[model samples]
Target: MRAEPESAPYARLGGEDAVRKLVNRFYDLMESEAQWQTPLRAIHPQDLSESKEKLFLFLSGWLGGPDLYVQRFGHPRLRARHGAFPVDDRARDQWMACMLQAMREVEMAPELYVHLRDAFQRTADFMRNR
Candidate 1:
């Protein structure tokens, strides 16, 4: 018997809603965690509500769902937008730590969790400008 083709984990994880939860938890950690509180506090806006929504919408399209971000905000030159900040290894690691904690809080399949974590790590690394 042939094996099934691997579907994109994002789709299997329920797409937009799952992605939204992940983003929400990530920001929650940034808001609460001491290690991240300082750096992220300076970088992020006083209110993260809109930022969280934007991330959720952006990830919805980025994970191969509806292109909501582009439809609303045009191109997502992520690096360009984030370039204004000093994102070094410490910042990247802090972001990943928050994301990982968020992933754990969400009830995703283990395989999907690992897949998403790895993907986020790579993306976070790429986002580092300093």
Candidate 2:
């Protein structure tokens, strides 16, 4: 038996298209859900179309794909960019909820789904400023 070389889960999960789908689902949840509507609605732009695209591109590079975000938006100082918003625990949790819902919508392998969800949860927690 041979051990398979470790692969980036992002690659195994289907790259850019999959990432875009996930972001789209996330935005959909934010747009529709009342729990997330207050804080998210205030912080997020009136139009989330660009937000979805930016998040997709940002995730593409963050997940080890081509550096499209940098090419277009320069450095992604995530914390800095988000600093302007009041991201308390509630806000972070709502963000995670949206992301988790989005992950569920994607047809990823179980292990891949767990890994991605955990990673997103941790990152969302880290982004909490309050």
Candidate 3:
């Protein structure tokens, strides 16, 4: 039998455990990092538990592991969902900063690091309302 080809980004990213760590770190950075905490963290609920889970579910499917978010909540409608908040350039940049720090903390591969940084930038930029 042929050796299996590399799996999706999720597996390459170390699956649920790694993804959970990344998400938690992402939130932790948002809550603790001085540069991003004010604008970005201010947008989140005072408590981050639910926000953390939602991002985890979203990223799980986004990374091609499981479609938990869609399965549980239907289409993400991410922008619509986020529309209630003001997501200007400052917000997007702050979010990217937090994610980049989290990615580094997780020690992701170089290629995947660049890929996620760019992808996250695009997604975060697209979320901008201003």
Candidate 4:
């Protein structure tokens, strides 16, 4: 039997395509939005292609779909991987702002939005190294 939508965020999110759209929108906003440019975008490399792909893979598994990131890149080690960057409250907030905007722009369900907003906040907070 198929997993219930409530039990599977990936399905609730419309699967891989929706996830990719959210990731792409997040990165696009980070790249284009003035508010995120310094705190969030500056920390990323000039090209966002790989960053976009990695986030997509990571979120795919994180949302209870295929574990593509682990399959391709092993454990996420999110904090450690992000340790090299100068992430702080500002960066975290800015990142969350961009993601929240993307989620809203994509019209995610209210319940899922609340769930993901809280979860993303915690993860973004955990990524802070400075």
Error of model 3, residue 64, in angstroms: 0.9
Residue range 3-116, candidate 3, lDDT tens digits: 222576777888889999999999998988788876798899999999999999999888888888999999999999999999999999889888998999996788988888
Task: State each model's C-alpha RMSD to the native.
Answer: 4.6, 4.5, 3.3, 2.1
List the candidate 2 regions with Cα displacement exceeding 4 Å. 1-6
Per-structure clash totals for the candidates: 0, 0, 0, 0
TM-score of every model? Answer: 0.89, 0.89, 0.93, 0.94
Which candidate has the highest lDDT of all?
Answer: 4
**Model 1 quality (TM-score):** 0.89
Model 1 lDDT per residue over 44-126, tens place: 88999889988987887777677778889999999998999988888888888888898899887898888888888999999
Between prediction 1 and prediction 4, the one with superior lDDT is 4
Compute the lDDT for candidate 2.
Answer: 0.82
Full ranking by lDDT: 4, 3, 2, 1
Candidate 2 lDDT, 1-130, residue by residue in tens: 2222337665776877888888888898998998898787779989888888889888877777767788899999999999999998888888888888888888888998888878888888889998
The local lDDT score (0 to 100) that residue 106 gets in candidate 2 is: 85
Identify the runs in model 3 with alpha carbons over 4 angstroms from their true place.
1-5
TM-score of 2: 0.89
